[model samples]
Every structure is written in C-alpha cells, then in structure tokens.
Target chain A: MTLLEIMVVGVLGLAGVGMYGLLISRNLIKIVVSLQVLVKGAMLALIAAGYASGHINLAQSMAVTVIVADTVVAVIGLALAIQVRRRFGTLDVKELATLQK
Target chain B: MLNAILVVGAVVGALQAIRAKRLLVSALWLAGCSAMVSILFYAMDAREMAVIELSVGAGLVTVLFVFAISIAGEDTSDVRAFVPKPLAWLLVLISIGLLGWMIIPTIGAPIPGVEPSFSEILWQQRGLDVIVQSGLMFAGIVGLLGLLADAKVPAKETAAQKQAATSIPPPPKALSQSPAIREEAHV
Candidate 1:
C-alpha cells in the first residue's frame, strides 16, 4: 500500500478504536481518553488531506486550530468529570442520569 | 518505512490507552499515542503542529488526566457499558467500514506546487481562526473556573452530616433556656 493508503487505514483504525471505547467505556476518564484518540485521528487526517492536496501550510494551520480546540475540550471534560465525582461520588456515566429525574 | 512504523505505533498506543485496566495506565498510554502522533506529524512535514502536539497533547493533557484521575479515584467497578460488548464492537466495525469505503477512493498523490510559508498562511489567510481559537481558550478557562467554584458536598457526605445532626440530642431544656430569664426570676 502507498503512504496515503497507509495513513488512511491508520486514521480509520484510530477512529474505530476511539468510537468503540466511547461506546463501551463507563468511566468518565475513559470517555475523555476516547475523545483524545478520535481527535488525534482527525488531526492526522487533516494533515494527510493537506499533503494530498498540496496545501501543507493550510493543513498545518488547521491542525493547529484543532489542537487548540481539542485542548480546551479535554480540559473542560476533565473538569466536568472531577466535579461529577465530587458531587456524585461515582464516575459511572449511567448514575449521572439520575439527575434527569 | 518510518511512516508505516509511526502509524502502527500510534494505533497500538491508542488501543492500549483504551484497553488498560487502570485509569492512570490508560492516561500514560494516551500520552504515548500522542507522542507517536507528533512524530507522525513531523514525518508529514508539519513540524509546527508536531511541536504543539508534543507539548500540549502529550505533555499538558497527560498531566491533567493524571491529576483528575488521582482526585477522582480509580474505583471503576460500578461503570458498565451502555450497550452490550458484542453490539458495540459490531457498530464500530460497521462505521469504520462505511467511512473507509467513502474516504479511501478520494485520496491521491500530493501535487507539488509553490506554496506560501506556514506563517504567511496562518497570519494572512487564517488570521480569524487564530483569534477564534484564543477566544475558545478563554472560554475554556472560564468554564473550568465555574465548574470548580460550584463545588458541593458529596451526596453521601451531606446525607451523613444530616443524619448525624438529627441524631444528636438537644441540649437540656433548662440549660437551653436563657440565663438572663433565670436570674430575673430569682430576683
């Protein structure tokens, strides 16, 4: 397989792992980890796309944007997770649904 | 060959991050994955992004995860997947297959061309994105402050305190009465 093909496969594999983790993991920290995995794949894909289109500069800039946004997301998610643990004493996502009632 | 190795390493690290039993171990695996991805970014000629990913993604984020995990504790027994294990795996596989089918055909060799430098593109063409990302960072900081400031006693502790308060006997009625009233009555 070509480099591009390998990258594409890697992207898909990473996304798949992330999605599966999101679906099955009950720990809030695990969920955030899954999100990190997914965003990494997206970053790779952006760079790969840029490389393919001969706009490496634009792609790199966009990847930087993604990095900034992703860091914020991760910070906020972990903060929320911490708050949840303090208030609820459990990290189980299922138990969080009790708030709905 | 190096590109292929980096890609494989990243995928393996991601897998380990998700599959690890301990949250701290998972976080360490995530850091490894991030580091591999940064190297991959370097291989792709996105050196600037590679540096940022290495610093923020691999370094800062891992510290934050570890801190949060330490505070939250690692009691994960109550956690259970929303869906059954087999069904979740099936769904993920199906999604990957569909996405691969749609995306793989469009990829082609990068066309060589004269392009502006990274700084020029970032400053001239994508200036707005930089400003917006800064705003997002500010918002994240404010949100974290809000979350931390809104702390409440845990439900279990609150309940326990309440029960303890109620179980305590009230002061003796005579002692509870005002001392001034007793002195006035004596006069």
Candidate 2:
C-alpha cells in the first residue's frame, strides 16, 4: 500500500476504536477521551483530503478550524462531566439516568 | 516507512486509551496518540498544524482531562456498557467498512502546484469560517464560566443541609408549670 493508503487505514482504525470506546465506556471522562480520539481521526482525514486535492493550504485552514471546535467540545464535555459528578455523586452514565425519575 | 510506523503507533495509543482501566491512564494514552498525530501532520508538510496540534491537542487537552479526572474522581470501578461488547464491536466494524468503501474510491493523486501561502488562503478564502470559530470560542468560554459558577455550591454545605434535615429536633418545653402537671409530677 502507498503512504496515502496507510494514512487512510490509520484514520479509519482510529475512528473505529473511538466509536467502540464511546459505545462501551461508562465513565464520563472515558467518554470524553473517546470523543477526542474521534475528532483526531476527523482532523487527519481533513488533512489527507487536502493533500489529495492539491489544496493543502485550504485543508490545513479547515483542520485548524476543526481543532478549535474540538477544543471547545472537549472543554464543555469535561465541565459537564465535573458538574454531573458533583450533582449525582457518580460518574457512571447508567447511574446518572436515575435522575429522570 | 516512517509514516506507517507513526500511524501504527497512533492506532495503538488510541486502543490503549480506550482499554486502560484508570481514567488517568486513558488520558495519558490519549496524549501519546495526539503526539503521534502531531508528528504525522509535520511529516505531511503541515508544520503550523503540527505545532498547534502538539500544543493544543497533546498539551492543553491532556491537562484539561487530568484536571477533570482529579475533580470528578478516578472512577476505577468496572461498569457495564449500555450495549453488549460483541454488538458494539460488530457495529463499529460495519461502520468502518462502509466508510472505507465510500471514501477509498474518491482519493486521487495530489496534483502538484505552486501552493499559496497559508495566511492567504485562511484570510482571503476562509475568513468567514475564522470569524465564526472565534465566536464559538467566546461562547464556549462564557458557557464554561456558567457551569463553574453553577457548581460552586460546596459539597460540604449540601451534606450539612441533608444532615440537618434528617436529624430529630428536641421537643419544646411548656411555658410555666400548670397545677395539674405539678400535682401529677408529685404523685
């Protein structure tokens, strides 16, 4: 396989692992970690797409935008996790559902 | 060859991040993965992005995760997943397969060109996106402040309130002793 193929595989693998992590993890912090992984895969894909299209500059700019957005997501998710733990006394998503009743 | 190695390292790091028992360990693995991704970006000729990813993805984000873990507790206990493990794995595999099939055909050899400067593309072509991103950042800062302010009620205070509410109160004493009460006491 070529270098581009390798990068594509890496992107797919990372995204898959991230999704699996999100699906299986119960801890809020772990969920955040998975989300970070997922976003990294997306960033890689953006850059790769740019390289393919001979628009590296455009791609890099978009990647930068994604990075900023991702940071905001991570910060907000962490903040929400902290608040959930404080209010509910458990970090488990399953336990947090008890609040509905 | 180096790119392949870096990609493998990144994937492994991500796997470890997901599988680690402790939240802190998972966070550390995520940082390692981010570091590898930054190096990959540098190799791909996106130097500015590499630097930003190194600092923001590996550095700032990891610090944030650590801070959050410290405040929220490690949460080391093994909890059951909402979906069964086998089902989750199958779903992920199917999704990845579909994505790869759809995307692989579109990839083509990169056409060489006299590339424009990064700043030119960002400022001239993507100016609107940058402005929107700035707004998003400001909003995120404001939202984070709100969350922190809302969470400022001390845990100890809530616990104290609960204790006070649950504790039995002493019975009130009668004002001036009545004659019948005094006689009954004497008897």
Tell me, by DockQ, which candidate is best: 1
Per-prediction DockQ comes to 0.69, 0.66
The lDDT leader among the candidates is 2
Q: Tens digits of per-residue lDDT for model 2 on B46-147? A: 888999999999999999999999988988988788999999999999999999998899998777778889999888888899899999999999989888
Clashing pairs in 2: none
Query: Which 10-residue window in model 2 chain A sums to the lowest lDDT?
Result: A92-101
lDDT of 1: 0.89
User: In model 2, what is the error at residue B62, expressed in angstroms?
Assistant: 0.4
Residue B26 of candidate 2: its Cα lDDT? 92
RMSD of each: 8.4, 10.0
What TM-score should be assigned to candidate 2?
A: 0.85
Off-target runs (Cα >4 Å) in candidate 2 are B111-114, B150-187
lDDT of 1 at B100: 92
Q: Compared to the true structure, candidate 1 yields what TM-score?
A: 0.84
